[model samples]
Target: MSTAWAGGTDAILERMEQMTSLFVEETRKSMYKGESATHCEECGEEIPESRRLAIPCKYCVDCQTALEKGSK
Candidate 1:
C-alpha cells in the first residue's frame, strides 16, 4: 500500500481503538458500584440474579424503565 494510504489506515484504526476504550470505560462507570438489591424498591418484584450480577440495580428492568419514563 502507498505511504499515504497506510497513514490514513493507521489513523482510522487508532481512532476506533480509542472509541472502543472510551465506550468500555463509560459502561463500567455506569454500572452501580453499591450492593445489588434483592427486590425492587418501587415494586415488590424479586430482582433476578442475572440482573443483579450484571448491574447492582435497585429496581427490576420494567420498574426502572417506568421510573425513567415518568421522570421525563
Candidate 2:
C-alpha cells in the first residue's frame, strides 16, 4: 500500500541506520588502547591533559598535525 516515494524514503532511512552502525563499530575499533601517553612520542614534550583526554593517543598536537600533513 506504500507509495513509491514512501518506499524510497524508508530505504534511505534503513541505509542511513546501517551506515551509522558501521561508523560506530569502526570508531570503537580505531580508538586508542591502554593508558594515555603523557609525552609526545616524536618530540618528548609533555602532552597537555586536555589533549590526552581528547585523543588518548601517542602523539602531541604539533607532532600529530605534522604527521597528518605529511600523509596528505
Candidate 3:
C-alpha cells in the first residue's frame, strides 16, 4: 500500500513538472508576441532583418544566445 502511494505521488509530481514547463513556455511566448524592435534590447546592437523576421521579438543574435544560455 505504501509503495503504491509513493508511485502515485511520483507520477503526480512528474505531471506537475511537465505542466509547469508548458506554462512557462507559453507565458514567454505571449510576453514576446507582437513585440518587434530594430535593436537588441540588451546590448543596443542593430538587429538583422532576417533575425527580425525569424524571431519577431527583441534581442539580437548574440544577446539572444547569451540569454538562452543564462536561462539554461
Candidate 4:
C-alpha cells in the first residue's frame, strides 16, 4: 500500500515538474515585446488615427488582422 502511494506521488511530482517547465517557457516568450509584421505596433500603422492612440507599439492593422485570422 505504501509503495502504491509512493508511485502516485512520483507521478504527481513528475507532472508538476513538466507544468513548471512549460510555465517557464511561456514566461520567456512573453518577455519579448512583439512579433515582426512590417507595420508599427503602437499606432497600427503610420496612417491610421488609431495609431496615435496606441503609441509605442509595432504591428499594423492589416498584420494584426491576418495574425488573428491565422490563429483561428
Best by TM-score: 3
lDDT of candidates 1 onward, in order: 0.86, 0.83, 0.86, 0.61
What order do you get sorting by TM-score, best first?
A: 3, 2, 1, 4
Off by over 4 Å in 4: 1-4, 35-72
Q: Candidate 3's residue-wise lDDT over 2-68, tens digit each?
A: 6667658978999999999999999988978995899988989999989888777798888888888
Worst 10 residues of 3 by lDDT: 1-10
Residue 65 CA displacement from its true place in model 1, Å: 0.5
Off by over 4 Å in 3: 1-4
- Arranged by lDDT with the best first, the candidates are 1, 3, 2, 4
Clashing residue pairs found in predicted model 3? none
Count steric clashes of candidate 1.
0
Q: Residue 5's C-alpha lDDT in candidate 1?
A: 78
Q: In terms of TM-score, how similar is model 2 to the real structure?
A: 0.53
Q: What lDDT tens digits, residue by residue, belong to model 2 across residues 1-72?
A: 757676599789999999999998888667666767999888999999998887677878888899879962
User: For residues 1-72, could you state the per-residue lDDT of candidate 4 as single tens digits?
Assistant: 567676589789999999999998887667534644345554446535465355433456665567658852
Candidate 1's residue-wise lDDT over 1-72, tens digit each?
567776588789999999999998988667665798999988879999999998889898999899779962
